[model samples]
Target chain A: MISQIAFVLVLAAAIYFIQKRFGRIRKNINLGKNRDFKDQVDKRLNNVLLVAFGQKKMFKRLIPAVLHLMIYVGFLVINLEVLEFMIDGFAGTHRIFAPFLGGFYTILMNVFEFLAIAVLVSCVFFLLRRNITKVPRFFNAEMKGWPRLDGNLILFTEIILMIAILTMNATDQLLQPISDHYPTTGELFFSSLLMPLFAGLNESTLIVIERFAWWFHIVGILGFTIYITYSKHLHIILAFPNTYFAKVEPKGHVNNMPVVTNEVKSMLGLVSAESSAPPTEPGRFGAKDINDLTWNNLLAAYTCTECGRCTSECPANITGKKLSPRKIMMDTRDRLEDVGNSLEKGGPGLNDGKSLLGDYITKEEINACTNCNACVEACPVLINPLEIITELRRYVAMEESGSPASWNSMYQNIETNFAPWKFSPSDRFNWAEEKK
Target chain B: MNIVTMAEFAAKGESPEILFWVGCAGSFDDRYKRVTRAFASILNSLDVKFAVLGTEETCTGDPARRAGNEFLFQMQAMNNIQVLNGYGIKKIVTACPHCFNTLKNEYPELGGNYEVIHHSTFLQQLIDSGRLKFEGGAYKGKKITYHDSCFLGRANDVYEAPRALLIALDADLIEMKRSRKTGLCCGAGGGQMFKEPENGKKDINVERTEEALETGASTIAVGCPFCMTMMSDGVKNKEREQDVKVKDIAELIAEAKGLS
Candidate 1:
């Protein structure tokens, strides 16, 4: 009964933590009206059947993929042991999987045990890889503290799990107490070889020891859950949801730009019937701030794994420009949070009620972008960096005539001359005559 | 009254010899003179009688359209379309991708719908049908890399037609790794042709031109007048004017026909 209570308690706790984390995600989104908000949830269901559960991106790097699969499946199998520990501990009979799992399960459990051991060993190698190669952002940055904690927790969980499995299998052999549900004489490879050591053991004493092993497994999993919720291991669960909402098609297409309403100074172009016409300004492009960016833009920032894949691919970054795609995402989050916090703390008098674009993000940073979708495309997870940057540009050029002098002249030319350079339209045929 | 596409225009009704809407780039820019001249020659070689829209041509306003200036683009597009309609010209061919894109794609929103073709595509059709023939070229040793104008490659899907023309003209086709749909900007889209590029690494065209040079090709071939000017400036900057050439596909065909 005590074991049953533990099972109920943990299941409730998992649900609770999951709900709490999701609430924060929802709160941020609902806080503001996003410009072009695509319904990500509906798309998510379609994506999973087509993309995620299909294991597409992981398999893109095929050589190491099989190993990742091994580790992934290992967690799933051990989860069965976790449930059984809870169930049997409540009923005072902890060998829940033995009878129904069958003679095949005898062999299956052995294989499951062996795989757990294999994955655990591989994870150690993964840990060492982190230490030796030490990828700058992924393994060594601010996220490092959580990974270090979670990595050891997973390692410990695996070690403790394997030990419990071995101990359970050895119960009959060592004459320790346990249920008869587990085949004592000859089961799978390990159990069969060791059963002889407990050949003379009686039933009741054996049952007692089995219950102890169940408790160890339950506690190990609970510890892992708490660690996972707070660590980089969080991606294990979060990546699925994040990937589901990932942008699939090109976001920079003229089709994808959100039509801004011309209400009280909105949008770069396309006036609503209600908006009053304003005089033309030229050479103005890009966003000035965080709110100036679209809601999808904020999602991109929040969803970024900070793996620096985008930073590596950026031409501007490679050429020693101040732009780092990784930092671009972080800075969006930081600036928004900073402003939000200040506002929350009642800091008065803001800068034009404008966004992170002109006020915080400089023209150079925005201009440095080629609007190439490379950074967006290269991301393993879907992050559309260009759209957010472009929207910011639209705000800068349209709202303020603070465009560069050349564009100022050019915009003037386009306005007066009807071409970007203000060249004479009469000259159109002059070219044909010159060829004569 | 003409709402037909190129394929339709090629198939049915009266064949239009000169749906000639001289684009603003062709009209205003001087280096583009060779562009319209070559186009005229290609039309003459095909024995197609065409009337020039002359002064009837105004800016198609693609620059204003893309720069988020809707009112100006609409004003310009409607004005040009009304002039073309006044000439009773249903089919139009342009040497400029900007005008072609604006009239074909964007003008409809402003109540102007007409078929427009870039000169490469129009010329390719003439060569394919055997009306226009470039028997051989006197030009030699110039390895050419074709730079795709954004209006042609991305806004429209006209990637291969120009390359096919270049191949038929016996020009060595060296490709920049980022050609076709992934083509680098000529630093001239989003109405940026008229404005200066924001302070960034190098000018987008210079970077793109470098990509052309990296292919070890001397002559950078282009389909649009805007690309012609930008790539020409890049070649001049690299001081490769003597060794490397920037020629429009029209200019290339002109050389092949010994007309220039």
Candidate 2:
């Protein structure tokens, strides 16, 4: 009864903390401008299946893909054990499905044990890839301390959790005969192998170890659920909705702002189609702050796994520019967090005088982007970093008129001559008249 | 060869089958002028009725819009749309991918809608219908690699038309390592063509050029005018200008037809 009470309290606290963090993130994302990505339901569903569940984009690099798939598929399948653990925790029942499932339960636990070991092995390799191996993608300028530590923490946490699970099962298998309420089980393949090691240990001592390991395994998962809200592993949950709502438009199509289009039409004396109201404020042009960007842009930032596939594929990054597409997403997410904290502390976000543009991401990085959409393509979960980059670039150009002199000249030339060159529009066809 | 303007067509109370949008680069850039002429020559030889906006033609404002000047882009687009709507133009074709992309995708939102086709697809259609016969002379048996323009390939999913045209030339059509959707930019999209590229280890065009060079094709076939300039510069950078000639799909087709 006491153990059940303790379990309920711990689960409640974990739920509270997780909900609070997600609530804050959702509010922050809602602070951005409105965008309608509501079309093409069937296509978005297919994209989620292909990209997120099937791990389609991850296979671009074969070794990592297989390793990741092992952890991904293993973690998913092994978490089924968590359902039984939850029932045991809540109802104070041990192996509730054991009687009905019988041999299948034993077989299932064996599969889960094998997968737990696979997950453990995969986590070690991931740690090595991040720490020991000099993979360039993992250690760029943006991944200084916290990002690196967070990655290691996730792997270490997974390793420890897997170990605790296996140890708990091993002790449970050893203690099942002595304990009255303990579920009767067949000789499990993996955990039973460790029976001889505990054969020398007495009954009371074995129960203590089993109970301790069981508590650690469940609590560790609960803690991980909360920690993931703070870690890059948030992608584990967010990747589903992110890939589901991923842009279904042609990759080359840039969405035109209907508000701005109407404004332009009004200026052109073409009847404003959607001009229902006059401008609210003069300062609105493009994204000067996070608020000016679309909510989908904010959501993309939140969904970033920080895997740096984007940075690896970025032409600007590879060519030695300041632009790292992964950094762009990270900075957006970081700024959103900052904004959310300020808002929660009872203040307007922009009133804090910190913006995503200058503070987190710089103009130089935004300018370096070729708008190639390689980052969008490379993302395993279909997060579009280019959307954020383009929005910031739009901010700089429109709000501050902060384009470089050459671009300004090009703009002026286009306005006057209808071309980037400083020639008359009437002379547009002079090339045909020229000697070929 | 007869070349008429929209104004002339309007004056005559007549309409052409297609409005050939001579994009800014094709109208003014010295290098791209040849591509325009080649495509025009093919259109004339096939007895296809097409009219140019000519002196009334302005830039499609692709560079302006991509450079982040939304106001200027709309200004130019609105002006062009007014002219096009006034002409009652329906089908449009252009050799430039920038023009093709903007006019097809972006213009509809601004109440400027028309069936815009890129010249690569148009040329392929002509060939498929036997409207343009390929005699296959100089390009016959030549090894040619095609460069996918970012706007045409990734933005529009047009991987086949240019390749189809190349196959019609009776030439061995080879592909670079990064072809189709995976194609690298020629370092000239999103207004990067006009501005000097930001400091980098190497220019993107130089990297893409090295990839094209690795294919070992004697001729590099291109669809977009911006790519034509970039790849030509890339070849020139490698000092392989003489050995590996960069030609537009239209130019290659015209050459095969012995139009020059």
Candidate 3:
């Protein structure tokens, strides 16, 4: 009875903590300006189904894709066992599904055990990939301390959880005859292999080992759930929604600001232009801070897996430019977190002197981008770092009035000559007469 | 080749079937000017009524807009829209991907809507319609590789049209290791052509040119004027200019049909 009450209180605390952390993240993302992503339901649904569920983009690299697919499927499928554990933990019952499932329970337990082993094997290989082989993407300059450590930490935690699960089953299988209510889960295929190690232990010792493993496994899962929110592993949850709201328009099409478009249309007499007073901040044309960006942009930052696929494929990065698309998304999230922390600590009216521009992301980085859309194309979950880069570039050009001299000259040429070149538009057709 | 201006066509109380958007490079750059002439010659031969904007034509402001000078882009787009609308221009085609992308995608939201087609697609359509027949000419059995312009391929999803035109030309169409959707940039996109690139291990065009050279192709076929300039420079750097030629798809089609 005491153990049941203790389990209930710990589970309640874990749930409360996870809810609080998730709520804070949601609130932080909500701080950005609103933009409608309500269009293209059918397309978005298909994208989510393929990208998040099917892991479509992850299959680009064959070896790692197969390895990852194993772990991903194992992680999802084993969580079903976790559900059974949760019910059994709260009810203080032993193998509650065994009586109801009959022989199927044996099959189900065997599958879960097999997955736990696969998860362990995959986790070890992943650690080897990151630590020993040291894939170049994992060693990108931005992945210095916390990012690298977080990856290893998650792998280690998963390995520990798998061990706990296996040990619990092994001890439970051994003690099934001695314990009064323990159901006979006829030979869990994988865990039964470990039965020899615990066969010599007595009933009390086996019961202690089994209960401790059960406690450790449940607690470890709860802790991992909370830890993921604070890690790049947040993609495990956000990938679905982020991909669902991904931009489905033609990849090359730059979205025009409707406010600016309407103003241009009115100026062109496409419609009766509403003449309005321009008293306030006229040069505030692009995103200078998190608040200036749309909510989807904020969501993208939070959803970034820091997989470095975008950076690896970025033409600017490949050509040794200052820009790394991964870094752009990271900086956005960091600056957003910084601002959110400041606001949380200091009331609603308090301001943080630092902004996403200049303080976090540099002008050099944004300028180096070729706008090739390679980063956008490379993102597995449809995160678009180019959108944020363009927005920041827009800020540099409009708000700060800081474009390169060459670009300014080109702008001037466009304004005056109606072309990027100095040639008169009258001479535009002169090329047609060329005999070459 | 005689090219009629929209103004001349209007004065004659007639509208051409298409407006040939002579982009800045097509209008001014020496090598690209030949591409423009070739396309115009083909259109003339086909009797596909087309008119140039001539003095009234302006930059579509792709570079300006891409470089983040939205104000300049809006001004340029508005001016060009005014001229295009006044002339009652509907169908438009350009030999440049930069202009094709902006005119088709960007201009519509800025109140400058027109049916814009890239020259490769337009030429492909002409060949399909039997208006321009592709014959085995100088490029017969010649190994040619097509370089996708960023604005044309990934930006606008125009991977097939250029290939279709190349295959129609009866040339041995070879593909670079990275072609179509996964094509590399010519290192001259997004206004990088106008400025020195940021310090890198190598230039993107040089890398792309290496890929093209690896294909063992004699001709580096291109669709965008920017790509033509970049790929030509890449070939020259490799000292293969005397061997491998960088020709636009329009130039190839015009030659295939013996238009001029």
Candidate 4:
């Protein structure tokens, strides 16, 4: 009776929270124009196959990826057995699961337990690798991003699931009498391995122990349920939607039609399309602050796992430029936190009064980006740091008259010589005339 | 003769089969003109009497506009549009991919639109129409690879046209590990051709040149003048200039089939 109730409570919580977050994600993706819908669908299917299933980008470092995938895949597989156990506990039936594959699920469950042991060994190796690499504190190297809260929540969730499996197995062995007609079947991989020592325990003693395991296992899963909703690890649900909505092509191609307008304008302050007054500078084409950016930009930052894969692939970061694409996403996420915290306390939004490119990031970061797609390409879940980076540069130059001195010099040369070099305009067709 | 975008030029009264605009690159750079002249020979051999805008061809102002110097770009584009209206010339073509992209895509925004074709695309079409035939001659058995220029490849999706031209000439096409749409920039897009590459691990063209050498191709084939110029400099800096050759697509085709 205790087990059945526990099953209903945990499963109910997981479903409810997952669906709630999924709704937020769906609303965010619908913000853009409908032109890219077919393209988005094609890319989404590709992302599910590549990023989610194949673990394509995760293999940049092999051993840890193997360890991580083991833990990941194990979590997926062992949970099936978990569901079966939960249903059996609630319904008062040992045969609640394993009916589908002609006794095949019984063998599959045992096989998976053996695999779970291997996954645990890989997790130990993963822990060692991170320690050696000094990438500790999974959220941020410093206290700049998602906070230690999210990592702890994820780690805690994993630990709960692991302990639940071990504790439930131990209790079952301790109270073999509860096994009764099923003989607490040595069919389980780990349980059978240790049953030799417990073969002589009394039925009553075994029954009491079974109760302890049943309680501990159910509570572990329920606690993790609540924490998942409020953490950066929410990508466990959002990553799918985020990847599905990722752009299939390059980001630099601007549409022939301009879409943004001055929202603050009233009356005849703004006439539409080639009016004699001439379109009052079109209110910041790139971005100045969080408000100027799209909702998907914020969503992209929120979905970041802080894997540092973005930083690794950034051309600017590699060349010792001040820009770390990982930090760009992390800073945006932090800005949301810092701003969100302030707003909760009735404070200002992100960037307050300063421009994002100049104050939050730097001119050094802006000029350093090669506008290469490396960071976007390397991102596992499709985060494009260059969009906001370039857009900010565009805003600073167009809106603020903040051209780089070198670029301006080249621009002047282009005006005079018809080429960027210091040649005379009279020489423009000299080579062709000489040829003819 | 006068220069304008393919769109505005098309409004002209002339019904010429082809209108050739020898871009400023063709006018100023020796190697660029060589490539253009070679391309011109191919077009003429196919019995096409193409008009050359000559001194009347004003700058497309792509560099100025992309560099955020909109005022200057407008001035140059308007001047060219006026000149083309005087030509009564409609059909248009360009050997320089940047000129081709500017005329076909950017000019529409400036109201100087017309039907524009890159020389490789025009030459390939002429070949497909069976209007031109190769004058067979001695060939070099060298490994050759093509570098896709940003304007030609990404901006306009013109990757296959140049490669198809090379294939017709029977040049060995060794694929770079990074080619097609994902091809790396030659550090020459967005008016960088007029400016130095002050960012990235190194100049992008130098990195691209390293990628080209990795292909072990004896010669690097180029469809865009900017890519050809940059890659040539890159090959020299890498100290493999003697081993790695850079040739324009037209030059390679002209030499291979002895069309020139």
Number of the top-ranking candidate, with DockQ as the measure? 3
State, as a TM-score between 0 and 1, how close model 1 is to the true structure.
0.69
Off by over 4 Å in 4: A1-186, A189-235, A248-252, A255-282, A306-320, A351-355, A372-374, A377-380, A410-432, B1-12, B16-31, B48-139, B150-168, B172-183, B199-201, B214-216
Q: How do all the candidates rank in terms of DockQ, highest first? A: 3, 2, 1, 4
TM-score for chain A in each prediction = 0.67, 0.96, 0.96, 0.75
lDDT, residue B14, candidate 1: 47
lDDT of 3 by residue, B162-239 (tens): 999888877799999777766888888777877778777888888889999999999999998888988999999999
lDDT per residue, candidate 2, A1-436, as tens digits? 9999999999999899989999998898899887677789999999989998999999988988988998998889988988988999999998899988989998898888888888889989998898888689998999999999999999999898888877778888877887887787777777777667778688888888888888898899989988887778898888888898788877777778666776777787777446646766645777767888888888888888799988987778887888899998898888888888888899877778778788888877877777777777788998988777666767778878998778899998888887898878777877666667
Which digits, one per residue and each the tens of the lDDT, describe model 4 over residues A211-326? 55555655655555456545666565556656766655534332222322222122324445544454565555556665566666667777787677667544345444466887
TM-score of each: 0.69, 0.95, 0.96, 0.73
Q: Per-residue lDDT tens digits of candidate 1, residues A1-436? A: 6657766786678668667655544444344335443666677676655444555555644644566666777776757665665566557563556667667656766776677666766666655655666644344233445436655666566666766666676664454234344544335465556567556657766656655665566666665666554333554555555566665432334322213222212333435555555544422234565544555566556555555666655555544455666667766755655555455556641343655664556777655665445466456555666665555555555667544566567656755666666667555445644524
RMSD of 3: 2.1
B1-260: candidate 1 lDDT, tens digit per residue: 11222234444554556576656666676777657767777667666766566555566756544554444455565566666665456677888877777677655544466677778888889889987776655445558899887778755778899999888877778889877755776766555565556555566667777898899987788988778888888888888889888888888887778776
Give residue A194's lDDT in candidate 4 (0 to 100): 58
Interface RMSD per candidate (angstroms)? 5.8, 1.4, 1.4, 5.5
Off by over 4 Å in 2: A194-197, A272-277, B135-141
Candidate number that wins on TM-score, 1 or 3: 3
Candidate 3 lDDT by residue in tens digits, A99-151: 89989999988898888898899999989999999988898889999999998
DockQ of candidate 1 relative to the true structure: 0.22
Which order, best to worst by TM-score?
A: 3, 2, 4, 1
Off by over 4 Å in 3: A262-283, A347-350, B137-140
Residue pairs with clashing backbones, model 3: A425-B55, A426-B55
Please list the Cα RMSD from the true structure of every candidate, rounded to 1 decimal place.
Answer: 7.5, 2.1, 2.1, 6.3
